[model samples]
Target: MNNLLIGLVRALRHHHWLRLLGGAFMLSSVGNGLTQVVVFGQLLRWHASPSALTLAYVLATLPGFFGSFFGEKGCRRVPPLRLLILTELLGMFALILPLLGMFYHNIPAMLAVQSVAAFLAGMSYPALTLTFKQGLSAEELPAATCMETLIFSAQVLLGTGLGVLLFEVFSPLTLLSIDAVSFVAAILLLAATARHIHLRPLQEMDTPPQVAVIRWAGLSILQKRSLLLLPALAAVGSPAMALLPAIAQQIRPGDATGLALPLLFARSLGQLCGPLLLNGERLRHYAKSNRHLLMCLGIFLAAYGALPLLAAEKTTALGLIFVAHLASNVVFALGTFSVLAYFPAQSVSGASAKAWRWQTLTAALATTLAAGLAAQWGATQSLYAVSLTSLAAVALILVRYRQ
Candidate 1:
C-alpha cells in the first residue's frame, strides 16, 4: 500500500501535465457532483416528483451521444494544449450560462441547458478520454489507472455526503456559483500548463480520411472482441444501483431513503478495495483477460440478484448484496482496465466510446425493466430475470473464451 502511494506521487511529480490533468479531473468531478446535488435539491424545492428527476437525468445524459462525436472532431485538429484549454472553456461556458440564468431568476430550459453541456462535452470527449489513455506515457499506465480508480472511489464514497451537506448549508444558487468558479479554475489551469502536454506526431494522421475509415473498419480480431463483444455482454451483466430504492423499501418500508445511503456507501467501499486488490505486476495480465474478468462480474451480479431469496429478510439480504455489489465493482474495474490496456487507438472513432456509455444505458434499461417485471411477475420473478440476464452474459463470455 505504501509503495503504491509512493508510486502515484512519483508519477504525478514526474509528469507535470499528468498532475495538471489529474487535478483538473478531480476538481471537475467534485464540482459536477456538487452541482448535481444542487440541481436535484432545487427540483425537490419546486416539489418536482420522482419522474421529474428522472427526466432531468435523461435530459442531461442524452446529449453525450452527440457530444462524443462532435467533441473529437475539433480535438483532432488542435494542438493538445489548445484542445485541452478549449474544452475547459466550453465546459465553463456551458456550466456558467445556466448559473447566470439562475442568478437572473430566468431559469433556463432544462432540456436545452442540459443538452448544451452534453453537446460541448461530446466535442471534447475524445481529448478528455485520451488524457488518461495517452496523456501519460505507456510506462505509467498501471500507476495512472490505479490512481484514477482511487480518485473515483474517493469521489463516490465521500462526495455524495459532502454534496448533501453543501446543499443544506447553502442555497442552490450558491452551489451553482461555486461550480461555475471551479470550471473557471480548470480553464485557467489548462491555459497556464498548456506547454507541458505533449502530443506526439502520428504518421497515421497523414493517411487519407477514407483509408483511415477503412482501416478502422478492419480492426484486429482481438480488438473486435475487446471493444465489441465484451461490452455487449457486460451490458446485461451490469447491475443498476437505481433499483436500490426499491430493494430498500422492501426492507425498511418507509425509511427507504435513509437506508439508501448506507447501502451505497458500502458499494463505494467495495469500489475502493477493488483497485487495491488488482495491483502489483499482475495488473497487466488482469487487464488483458477480459473474458474471465467479465465472467467474475456476471457471477457476482447473479449472486446479487439472488439476495432476496438467500437472506429470508431485508436486512440480511441487504448485507449480503452489499458484499456482492462490491465484488461487482471489482470485476468491473478489472474488465475496464482490460479495455484501456488493449483497446486499439484507431478504433476510437465511436466504437470504443460505447464501452462506458453502453453499460450505463444497459443499467438504466435493466432498472426500468426490472420495475415493470416486478409489478407483474413479483419481486422474486423480477430478480430471476436479472439473474438470467447476468447468466446469459456469462454464457457469452464462456463461449467467446473457448473460441
Candidate 2:
C-alpha cells in the first residue's frame, strides 16, 4: 500500500500535466462505466441473444484495430497533443448516436455507436502513449503505468457501482447523457494539459523516418520475437471478460441484473489492488523475464476458467474473478512496460501503434469466438476453450524463448 501511494505521488509530482491527463481519463471513464452498465442492463432486460451481446464487444474493438493505422500516421505528421485533443472533441459528438439509439430502443443503432467511439479512442492511443514517453523519463515510466492502472481500476469500481444505483432511478437516455457530459469535461482537461507541454511532431524529432525504420530493423531477434507475443498476451482473459454478462446470467439465472454489480465490483477491486501488490519495481523485473510472467498468467487464467466448472455458487465465483483480475492486471502492467521500455524513444509511437492493431484485432476475434461458443455450447465452456488456447499460445512462446 505504501509503495503504491509513493509511486503514484512521485509520478504525479514529477509531471504536473499528468494530473490533468489523469483527470480527463477519470471523468471520461466514469461516464463510460455508467454508460456500459446502462447498455448491458438494458440488453439483459430485453433478453438480448448471446450473439447480440458478443456483437457489441466486437464492434467496441474492431474499429479501433483499424484506427491504429491512421493514428500512427497522425502521430508522425501532427503533434500528438493536438491530435489527442481533436479525438476527444470528435468523441464528444459521437455520443449522440447512442443517445438517439436509446430513444428508439434500437440495439443495432446503439451498438453501431461503439464503433465510432472506439475508433476515436484507437486514434488517440498512440498520441496518449507518446505524451507519456515525451514527458517522463525511463525511470518514471513504470510508476506512471502503475498510476494509470490504478486510476482505470478506480473508475471501473466507482463507475459500475454508481451506474447500478443510477440505473435504478434514471432512464437509459439520462445515463448516456451523463456520459456525453463527461467527454466535454475531458476535453476541457486536455486543453489545460496542452498548455503545459510543448512537444514537436514526431517527424520533427531528431530521428528521421528512414533512420527510425532502420533502428527498428536493427533490433535483436529476441526483441523481435517478444513483440510477436503481444497479441496473444493481450487476448488472455479477454474472452471471459467479454462473456461476463452471459456468465452472470448463467450463474444466477433470473438475477443477472442484481448479480452484475458485485461481479463487476470484484473485478474492479482486483484491478485496483493489482498494481499495489506488484508495484513498478516488480513489474520492471517481470518485464525483463517475461517467461515466468507468462507462466504465471497461464496458471491464473486456467484456474479462473476451471473454477466455474467446479462450483456453482456465486460467492465462490466472485472470489475467483477477483483473484484472476488481480493477476491479469499485473501481466498487463508487465506487457505495457516491456513494450515502452524496449523501444527507442523515436520508435515508440510507431511500435505502440502496431502493437495496438494486433492486440485489438486479436482481442476482438477472441471475443467473437467466445461468443459463438457461448451461443452454441455454454459460457463456461467458451471460457475454458479460450483459456486452453491462451495456454497453448503461452507454451509456444515459451518454447521459442528456449530456442
Candidate 3:
C-alpha cells in the first residue's frame, strides 16, 4: 500500500500533462457524481414510473452513439487538445438545460438536457484518450491508466458522499449549477495545460482516414472476442447500476432517501479500493487474461444480486455492494489497460471511441429491458436476472475461448 502510494505520487510528479488531465478528470467526475445523485433523487421525488426512469436513462445515453462517431471523425481533423477544450466549453452551457428542467418539474426537459450532456461527453472521450496516448510513453501508459482510475474512484467517493449530504440543503438547480462551475474549472485547466504541451495533430501523425476501421478489422481473434464482451458486460451491469437509487428505496422503504447515501458510499468506497488492490504487477497479470477478469466480475455481480433475496441486513448488503464494485473496477481497469496496450498509440482514440459507441447502445437497450422487468418482477428480481444473464454471457465467452 505504501509502495503504491509512492508510485502514484511519482507518476504524477513525472508527467505534467497527466497531472493536468487528472485534475480535469477529477473535476468532471465529481460533477458527474453530483449530477447522478441529484437527477435520480429528483426523479424519485417525482414518483417517476419505471418506464419514465428507463426512458430518461436511454435518452441520455443513446446520443453517445452518434457523438462517438462524430468525435472520432472530428479528432482526425482537429487537434485533440483543441477539440477537448471546445467540448468542455459546450458542456458548460449545456448544464443550463437541466437547470431549466428542474425549475419547471419537466421530466422531458431534464431528459433532453441529459442527452445533450451525454453527447458532448461522448465527443470529448476520443480527444481525451488521444491526448493521453500522444503525451505518454508506452511504459508510462499502465501507470497513467491506473492513476486515472484511482483519481476517478476517489472523486466518486468524495462527490457522491458530498452530494448526498448536500441534497437535503440544496435544490436540484443549485447542485446542477455546481456541476456547471466544475466544467468551467476543467476547461480552464485544460486550456492552461494546452499552452505548455505540444501535441502533434492527427495529420502530422500520418494516420489515414480508413486506418481506424482497418486496424479494428485486423485485430487478432482473441482481441476481437475480448472487445465484443464489453457490450454484453454493459447489458449486465448498466441497468442494475442505473437503478441503484430505486434499489435503495426498495431496501429501505421507510427511509429510502436516507439509506441512499450509505449505499452510494459503499459502492464508491469499493471503486476506490479496487485500483489500489490491483496496482502494479497484479493489474498487468490480469490484463493478460481478460476472460478470467470477466468471470470474476460475473461471479461477484451474481453474489451481489443474491443478497436481497437472502433477506440480508442493510449492513450486509452494503458490504456486498462494496465488494461488487471493487470487483467491477478491477475488471474495468484491467480491460481498459489491455485495450490501450494492444492498440498502437495513434489508433487508440478511434478504437476506444468505436468501442464506447457500441457499449453505450447496448447499455441503453439493456436498461430499457431491465426497467420493464423491474416493473413486472420488482427491482431486486430484475437485478438478479441480469446478473444471471451476465454470468451466462461469460459462460458463452469462455466456451469460445477454449476453441
How do all models score by TM-score? 0.74, 0.90, 0.89
Using lDDT as the yardstick, the better of models 1 and 3 is: 3
Better of 2 and 3 by TM-score: 2
List lDDT for all candidates, in order: 0.55, 0.73, 0.71
Q: Which residue pairs show backbone clashes in model 3?
A: none
Better of 2 and 3 by lDDT: 2
Best by lDDT: 2
Cα lDDT of model 3 by residue, 1-403, tens digit = 4333455677678878768877876887677678767776777778776567666777767788888887888877887888888877887777776677788888787778668767876787777778767776666666756765665575458778879889889887778878888888888888878876666544555445325552555777655644554565566677777666667767677676676667777888887777666656455566556476666676567656766664247787778778888777776666566566666666777777876787789888778777888889988778778767866776676566532
lDDT of 1: 0.55
> Cα deviation in Å at residue 158, candidate 1?
4.3
Instruction: Return the TM-score for candidate 2, rounded to 2 decimals.
Output: 0.90
Give one digit per residue, the lDDT tens place, for model 2 in 296-394.
576668657756664377787778878877877776666666667766667777777777777788888888889889998988888889867876876
Please list the residue runs of candidate 2 whose C-alpha ends up more than 4 Å from where it truly belongs after superposition: 1-5, 151-155, 198-217, 306-313, 401-403
- Per-residue error for 228 in candidate 3, Å, reads 3.0
